[model samples]
Target: MTRALILFAHGARAATWAAPFERLRELTQARVPGVPVSLAFLELMEPRLPERVAELAAQGVTAVTVVPVFLGQGGHLLRDLPLIVEQLRLDHPGMAISVSGAVGEDPSVLAAMTDFCVAQL
Candidate 1:
């Protein structure tokens, strides 16, 4: 089964806010050569989660792993995401969809951010 990774983030009105996410997608895509890696926004951006997932499903991707790039488990993660995922599941029943925790909650990511902050001192 073909699998893909979708880096999910809360989009901003400023177009430049997506630069980092786009870069993250590129870096991730490079790590997993064959697996499709993409970026999807929550709002104020194009290719929302459902749209991206549908594209993947159309491409015959049977599995999708969504990684929320948010900094914490806020309302967006607590409520919005579940609802969106529910619809995505219904929309693409043949595809297996799973979601990972917020990237900021990961110890490794937190450590990296800590390191950057420390360097600033």
Candidate 2:
């Protein structure tokens, strides 16, 4: 079963907002050499989550893990993501899709952010 990792983020109107996400994707891709690591946005972006997942599905990826790059669980995460995932499930029944909590919610991520903040002083 071919598996892929998708760093899902809320896209912004400004193109520069995607720079960090792109970097994260590249870093992740390097770590998982054979596995596919990609970035997909929720809106105001070129490749929306559904579209990216479809592309992966077409490429014979049987499983995908979606990691939300958002700082917190807001409306987009609480409302929009579930609906999208539901539709994706129906659209690609053969594929297994699972979603992790927002990156900001992770303890390690929070610790890292805290360290960065402390260093700013």
Error of 1 at 1 (Å): 1.0
Top-scoring candidate (TM-score): 1
Error (Å) of candidate 2 at residue 104 is: 0.8
RMSD of each: 0.6, 0.7
In model 2, where do residues sit more than 4 Å from their true spots? none
Q: What do the candidate models score in CA lDDT, each in turn?
A: 0.96, 0.96
Candidate 2 TM-score over all chains jointly: 0.97
In angstroms, how far off is 90's CA in candidate 2?
A: 0.4
Error of 2 at 93 (Å): 0.7
- lDDT score for residue 68 of model 2: 96
lDDT of 1: 0.96
lDDT of 1 by residue, 13-61 (tens): 9999999999999999989999989999999998899999989998999
For model 2, how does the per-residue alpha-carbon lDDT over 57-96 read when each residue is reduced to its tens digit? Answer: 9999999999999999999999999999999999999999
